[model samples]
Target: MLVGDRGSVSAELVIAIPLVLFMLLAIVQFALWSHATHIAQAAAAQGLAACRAQDGTAADGQASAQQLLDELGRGPLTDTNVSANRTADSASIQITGMASMVIPLLHLPVHAEAAGPVERFVPDLAGGR
Candidate 1:
C-alpha cells in the first residue's frame, strides 16, 4: 500500500465514529422516552382503579398514582404530577411529567390519562310486584 493510502482509512474512521455514536445516543434517548411514557400510563391506570372503586375519593386516586411514581419511576420521570377527578358516576386520573434527558439541549414531554365508571349498585326502576 502507498503512504497516501495508509491515512485514508484513519480519516474515514475518525469522521464516521462520531456519527455512529450520535446515532446510538439518539436511539437510547428514544427508548428512555418510550419507557417513561409507559410508566406514566400505568400510574394513571392505577389511580383510575383506585378512584373507580366503591366509596373511593379523588384523593385516593391521586395518592395511588403518586405512590406508583415514587416506587417505580425514579430515573425516567421528573417533575411528576398526578390529578384525579370524580363525578357521581365516573372517575378519571391524569399524570404528567418530563422524560429524563439524554441530550443536554433536548426535552421530551410525557402524559397519560385514564377513566372508568364508578362502582355502584342501582335499584331496579320498575315497581316491585
Candidate 2:
C-alpha cells in the first residue's frame, strides 16, 4: 500500500481484461464450431434416412439433407447448406458452415461429410423355413 504503487491495480486490470476477453471470444468461436458440426451430422443422418426410404421416383435424400441443415443451423451457421447424393449402393452428404469472430480478425470455415449404404431388410414371413 505505497503511494508509488497506486497504478499497479490499473495496470493489472488493463492486461487481464484483454486476456479474459480474448479467451471468451475463443470459447464462443469453439462453441459455434461445435454446434455447426452437430447440425451437419444431423443433416447427414437425415439424408441417409431419406435415401433408405426413397421410392425411386425422386431425389428426396438431397432435399432431406438440405432441409435438415436449414432447420438446425442458426446463429453462427445460419448461412449454411447441405449437399447430398445417392449412388446405386450408397448415399452421401456434406455440410458447409462458417463462424466469424471480432478479435484477431478470424472467420472460420467448417465442412464435414457422412456416408452410408442404403439400408434394407428382407422380410422373413416364412418363419425361418
In terms of TM-score, the best-performing candidate is 1
lDDT of 1 by residue, 1-129 (tens): 997698899899999999999999899999999999999999999999999899899999999999999988899988899999999999999899999999788899999999999999778888775
The clash tally of candidate 1 reads 0
TM-scores, each model vs. reference: 0.89, 0.80
**Who wins the lDDT comparison?**
1
Q: Candidate 2, which segments miss by more than 4 Å at Cα? A: 54-58, 100-104, 120-128
Model 2 scores what on Cα lDDT? 0.72
Worst 10 residues of 1 by lDDT: 120-129
How well does candidate 1 match the true structure in TM-score terms? 0.89
Q: Tens digits of per-residue lDDT for model 2 on 34-83?
A: 77777777777777678765452116767887776666676656567667
- How badly does each model clash, as a count of residue pairs? 0, 0
